[model samples]
Target: MIVNQFLVLGALLFSIGVYGVLVRRNAVLVLLSIELMLAAVNINLVAFGAFVDDAAAAGQVFALFVITVAAAEVGIGLAIVVLIFRNRSSANVDELDLMKW
Candidate 1:
């Protein structure tokens, strides 16, 4: 497959992720959308790393870092979601106002 194909796929996936984040009220769904966006970014990174001739392997390394960050994000995000559910009994994004004074 060509780099352009991967780029287009990534763009499509990212767009869907954005739509899910904007339209969904469920915290879990929003987190899943964020994961989708990260996956799209990873796809683009790997595609470019494979197609480019620089041989520095920076793109793959950066992708790995992004994966690590994403894992942490999921862990923290789920913990927050669980806490919210325990306190409020709902995972709806609109209902979360813990930061509001």
Candidate 2:
């Protein structure tokens, strides 16, 4: 139950997420990488909140907010990706240049 252990885990998760986002060209994979990053941030928030001597559950509450935002982002991002795939027939990030008019 060490805070440092949780921090290390969070850092590892964040690093993996960053690698996924940078290396994957698939739009869906990018979304998943973003979710992984958010999850890492939530882990840090909850770990700090549990270790700190604060009366209010600020870290947990903020984690909840991040979850909510992540949900909305996933919904909107998937919808956009779907639309792009439907129109372009491909979900590759490198081929999705919509502003090339």
User: In lDDT terms, how accurate is model 1?
Assistant: 0.94
Give the Å shift of residue 7 in candidate 2. 0.4
In candidate 2, list every pair of residues with a backbone clash.
Answer: none
Q: Give the TM-score of candidate 1.
A: 0.91
18-88, model 2: which lDDT tens digit per residue? Answer: 99999999999999999999999999999999999489999999999999999999999999999989999
Off by over 4 Å in 1: 97-101
Lowest summed lDDT across 10 adjacent residues in model 2 is found at 92-101
- Model 1: per-residue Cα lDDT over 44-90, one tens digit each: 99899888846788779889999999999999999999998999999
- Candidate 2 overall lDDT versus native: 0.95
Q: What overall lDDT goes with each candidate model?
A: 0.94, 0.95
